[model samples]
Target: MGGRAFSLNTPPIRHDVYLRLVSKFTTLLQTLHEIVRVAPHAPEKITHGDIDVLVASPLRTYTSEEPIALLGAEQCIPGFPTANFAIYEPEIEAYVQLDMRICPPEKIEWEIFYRSYGDLWNILGIMGKRVGISVNQAGVRVSVEHIEKKNKKAAMVHLTDDPRSAVEFFGCDWEKYERGFGTIQEMFDFCAGCRFLDVEISQRREKITVESRRLRDLRPLCQRWFDEYLPKLMGEEAGREIELNVHSREGVLEEALGKFDKRLDHDMLVGMWGKDLFDKEMWRRIRALLPLGTKRGNIVVRALAKRLEEADLGNGEYGALCESEEWRREREANWTEIAKAEWRVILAAVQ
Candidate 1:
């Protein structure tokens, strides 16, 4: 769902223009025998601002070479298998923001299942929360503890891998999610059938005033999706009773901090103390302990930073965190304000 945003003044492109851009990239990937599929965005829209594509190859790893070759260097936004870029459309004579997610051949089906769902995926994520199941790009985990035990890596469960268990757990139609829909209209119908839109609307109306601005942006998008798009697709209003309990923000933070403590204790027991080399995994573990923009997570981050500074990892990756300008810049860009402040304090003390 994360991608590069274009200039504020950028105009949206017509549906045909969007298709042309999709076709251009599809052809380029065909040469490399990589399978490509465009996500079913609002096909009925007059104009689109972005394109999302799923690319899969037999190769275990993917580089940005193919996308860079087609879209050019200036357009590419750096990332791992998931790359963001902008392509110039000859027909529209404008640039279209494109997000390309590269998946391993074996995991392509699950990737397609997740990527095509769009907001529906967010709805499923909410369902996941109710049942203590965590769903993300990697796959689904039963709990935050399970994720930490695996070092926060997705265990890679395919959709077909006992999906019925998940559906039954959430009390939804297993067949619908499995088979999906033939058309975008059918997909909208599926959303209505689940009464997800109704619950979403109710939740938004109730929480909009209290939620952060970042969360409020979705309100308009949800309104347009249902109020405008749904009625046009379904002809009638959709509503149903949803039996899910909502947890308070404080409760969520407490659960996250508890999980962080467990992970920290595990690391300490495994001798990840001061002797281990500082690497990307260590950096990720520290960042993971600090959930973005959360005071509690920032507290944990500060504690981890102090602990790391007191330890000795020789002249390993720890030095880069303080001395390397590039590393500092990247960390600052990715970290939240409180986290950046904590990290800077740690670096100052160590120096």
Candidate 2:
């Protein structure tokens, strides 16, 4: 919500139109960038709603470019790390949307992998959650220490942002995937090919809508997967040896942690005392204890950090400290027994 917003009225284009547009657009983009690629569309995606393209440009410099002048786009909408150019097509007399995504020069491959194949992310992301893995724009992450009480994202550790890691994790041959699929069914098979995929768990409407979008309205690819493809695969995947987290949300996190070097980060997020999460949580409770505005709140936090560092104490051990006579005398911050008890419960997590 805090990020940039741009409204676009570009419409879908036929496959033939898309094919022609991509080539011409590629040539135009090359004039401005050394690395420019049209993220491949999903197989059998005959009518494309937009062209998702990525370019390697540091500082997200491409976001400011006026594609309207260069490519004769009808309008250009600027966004952070992305810019949507509505290309005018005299043939269809409609605007074809072309989105230029900016990535670090070194991350073009990962960006392309993330942006390619329309419904591919939705399929993998939905299935990935059930198996304690997360495939996002950021990269391939494994849900290492999710406590379930907090957002699942809090516990995810980046495995790798490289495309190879994802294909390997999903049990697909990278070369073939790079070559692309000819049909949507082929793409589905590739995703479902992952050893951990329990087709039954994946097909469930409840599991598919794991996030806030409950009573889900399925996207086109997902709609077909739920209402069609998965049902067809039931017989084939019936006797399949489903490994890890498919039947239950267990041990796979530890399994992933054992593989990656993110244990220290995982520990901090799950509540290693005095870390960022612990510091933020402590600051939250302390702020509640003393109803201070922004300016005073900032001063109190700095002072609290100094006190804790000087004492060689963790924030989790400060609940009792907050209730002490010295704390009240120094900061004029006093909490009632009710507040102190509640703070103890909150601090108990990191303690």
Candidate 3:
């Protein structure tokens, strides 16, 4: 349901004009950033929707608006490390869009590669997901067990910092990726070589589910792959193309764990230490120990979360006061008074 929350309708860029702007902006933005470059154009592409510019964040020594001013864009919709800028073109007498993506100094390289070749990663991500790995602006991550239905961020175990290595793990030749694709077909062929890819599963029409990502297949290059290449390949290959044991999500997750050397993380995830599960259990115990309503429980839990580690509780942080030796000793000494204390007295003491 969550789609791109912002959009700018602007005229497409002519290849010649796009080059001019890319050169111009590359020169201008460098004045304000250490690393600045445009993401690669899709091979054999003549016109483009927008100029995708990437910048390393914590701008060299300027304000967030510095790059917009430098590019001479008439308007900008600002975001952290991302902004949409529109420059007026005299020939078309309309705005041409520039998407500025800012990333960490360390991550700028991966971000640039990930954004390159246009929609390539989207296809790769679909292939990765079948194997329980995901590639995004951030690099490789293991999709941990069922925590996404609760907290998506906590559900991921970050695996590696470098995507080139991650890409190789998925079965693409690094040299081919470096040299770049010669034609749109060549790019598709490059994707076809990925070892983790199941041609039948990767190209399934029914698999286009996420609203925003579905936009990738709508692009001209991807549309051809879906409507033409895949169907023909499936028909010609006969029974060989369909996986013998269609990789189940569970099967792939286990495969990725061993392949990626993430077995220790898998053990922790299944051992009741996954953050979401642990917190849920901790809160259940907290509710019982405190015997308080939601509002008061929130205040107490937050205070507990904020407190300094001034005690010797087994877990460093106690799940409930009963887990704290100090609290237990106090309760044992004042059992008669503490057992029947009013919630107001408890709240006052905590505050």
Candidate 4:
């Protein structure tokens, strides 16, 4: 497991304990730079699994080495422009995951907006998608045409630049868009007023089963947003409709899975299981099985493994899958041809 993995039975950090740790970390970060923003901002009273900080400076780049040296980080996982460090907190008596994202001063505002409010951003993203406005780490853009055609470069367009457009489209306050909310109540009020709240709730619930651990932690906030706050903001009738739709969708997915299982024969079942295992763990095994020879062969295998990992399928499964004789045989049988095809494609691209 990576540095952040904890047993499912791990207890939540008390709010007071969390604040003390954050205050200590913030003090240390402030000594490094003046422009540091901690996430889950201002008035949201909730338990956090990790602390996320955005550090911006005029400098071109920042590395994890500084933080590793300063904080005595147990592990540093390099993420190119952004890095994650596991630092021990004496108060909590456990390792706390800290994600430090270093960016140029110009991008600080957008970075803060992107990282601060997780559930709020998710809800806003749903609304943005409905109306063809895409909001991402890069920036908010109405369409792909906003992207530079030649280099495919794009800068994040500020929401404040055209606040009225978003306000009209999403029915949120322009003031809140410019200045971040001071309390969770403000966030609830803004989302509660949005016409797209139902859609946002539906999408959030749909992702509950499939979301990664980090995203899963936001479920409580989202649930409160829909189950309690929205109903009060809207009418009880609208709240009931939202709940009904969520239940309906869950039932439908469960029914489909049951039917699919019934239709799968023994070989089909094994194939499905194998496919799932392959998607998760096959790439590393493939790399391990690659025959040692030319530098190009090693490069191709590494590149393929990197690509699969980027796709969220490189690792994190039971090792027993890799030990299967059938899987090993199949992988070995196809590896030569796969490597040849990959090399040919690389050559074609270069030529």
For residues 140-212, write the lDDT of model 1, one tens digit per residue.
Answer: 4444343334453332222222334434434467778667665556554555544222344443555433332
Stretches > 4 Å off in candidate 3: 1-9, 57-60, 63-69, 202-208, 211-213, 242-351
- What's the TM-score of every candidate structure? 0.51, 0.73, 0.73, 0.50
lDDT of 3 by residue, 1-351 (tens): 011223544766788988998898888887777788777878888877777788774444677677677778887788866788877777667678888877778988888788788868776776777656788877788776576556667667767767677778777888888889879888887877676666565356576557324654566666666667667766766665455336666776777677778877655544433433444555455545676778886676555534412332234233343345566545344432332354458867878
Q: Where does model 1 exceed 4 Å of error?
A: 1-10, 58-66, 71-74, 144-169, 174-189, 192-216, 219-221, 224-351
- Among all windows of 10 consecutive residues in model 3, the one with the lowest summed lDDT is 308-317
Question: Which lDDT values do the candidates have, in the order given?
Answer: 0.52, 0.65, 0.67, 0.56
Q: Pick the candidate with the highest lDDT.
A: 3
Candidate 2's C-alpha runs over 4 A off are 1-9, 58-66, 145-148, 202-208, 212-216, 241-250, 271-302, 305-351
Residue 319 of model 1: what lDDT? 20
lDDT of 1: 0.52
RMSD of 1: 13.7
Q: Whole-model lDDT for model 3 versus the true structure? A: 0.67
**In model 1, what lDDT does residue 113 have?**
58
What TM-score, to 2 decimals, does candidate 1 have?
0.51
Better of 2 and 4 by lDDT: 2
User: In candidate 4, how many Å is residue 242 off?
Assistant: 16
